[model samples]
Target: MTDSLKKINKQIRFLSVYAMVSSVLLLIALFLILKKDRITGNLTVEELTANRINIVEPNGLPRLVLSNVEKSPANLNHGKPFGIPGGNRGGLIFYDDEATECGGLVFSGRKDSSGKYFASGHFSFDQYNQNQVLYLQYLDDNGDRKTGLYVDDWHNSPPYPEFRRTYKETEKLPNGPERDAKLKQLLEPVNGDPAFAHRVFIGKDANKASLINLSDKKGKPRIQLIVDSTGEAKINFLDSAGKVVYSLPNKANH
Candidate 1:
């Protein structure tokens, strides 16, 4: 080839290589800019405030909720318009991946019409569409107090939907004998023969006695071991009627 042709060809080859390199570099820079915009490394904030905050999963399912009194969200157990007077109580609520309320910590205190003070703090875990299966609670009513831990059993049939429906219906009824009777009938399955009942209670009772109570599935306390305020210890076995069947160390002895 002639020197001039060779030189021309060499120049074209160099320019071609340079163009390819420039295109790759530009593409890489564009990719980095897009990545930077899409990512967040860390953030710091001075203060954040809101009535309620929900932490959710990528699919928008709520996993946790931190809320003030007025904004507390109701759970599956309570459904909507929580029948209780303290639905506005402040608390941190937790939900399962399915967004079912599993448990939470709650607290409230108020005075009744009779000027009697009442307060309670509870941290509980539900039995999947059922009432609280386990809980730690502190309750004070007009200076009478009881702090305890409880584990309860629920009937398997009828399920949560029926329970929630009955609860809402009962709430609409007027406060009278009729309502009371309806409540009793509706609750008969749960309260009367409860498939399983209060299984365990470990706490201090209103009389300032420290006790551990174990009950039968029929809701009858079968055994109670107690230490009274004066430090007297007694263990009692009771029948279904709650009448003491027998006592250890005899009631007369400390």
Candidate 2:
């Protein structure tokens, strides 16, 4: 071939290779951008499996966590841990905007040796920085079961960790009047009233009675609407001491 023709052919070949490289680079850049968009936007997958998954906000504050028993997280208050480490059971824990533990649903059911079995499920929500104020729980141990919806009261003066610390301190003391008095004082922080109480319970008890119990501030049952296992129904109203003062069908009627 002539020199001029050979030089023109060489130039064309170089340009062709450069164009191919540039096109490949452009395709790669587009793929990267699209991948980032999928990450920040919505990603669909057929299956997901993980020991723990934390859904967080832009600020890295966790809003929810789904975890197995071994990977569950400790309770949090204002982004800090308190009380005990979690990992007690598998469940989902929810948090507030401040990263405080707001609520959770945990469940466990297992059969041990000797044919003994136990199962429990608890769903609860706290009262802001305080302890659980409402819950639905089911407990079954060797055929003895209690399922209930509970409404509780918590102290507003101290945070839950502080209250727990005080209780633990009191528990370490020798069992006697002094320890009892300290425990009592810890629970009754404001005036002589009880700080925490189970205000309401509506469910079946271990005794095979379906009942709705409404208690006083001190957690003493004041009114009970019961349907016993025998299908007998009764409404009882008690005084502060919890002694039944009145009944729907009086003893004479019975």
List model 2 lDDT by residue over 1-254, tens digit each. 69999999999999999999999999999999999997686877999989999999989999999999999999888999987787787999989989999999999999988889999999999998888999999999989999999999887878887888889888999999999999989988778778899999999999999999999888999999999999999999999988998998788766
RMSD of 2: 2.6
Each model's backbone clash number = 0, 0
Model 1 CA deviation exceeding 4 Å by range? 1-40, 77-87, 110-116, 168-185, 190-192, 251-254
| Per-residue lDDT of model 1, residues 106-136, tens digit only | 9999898889998999999878766678999
Q: What's model 1's lDDT at 225?
A: 97
Cα lDDT of candidate 1 equals 0.82
Global lDDT of each candidate: 0.82, 0.92
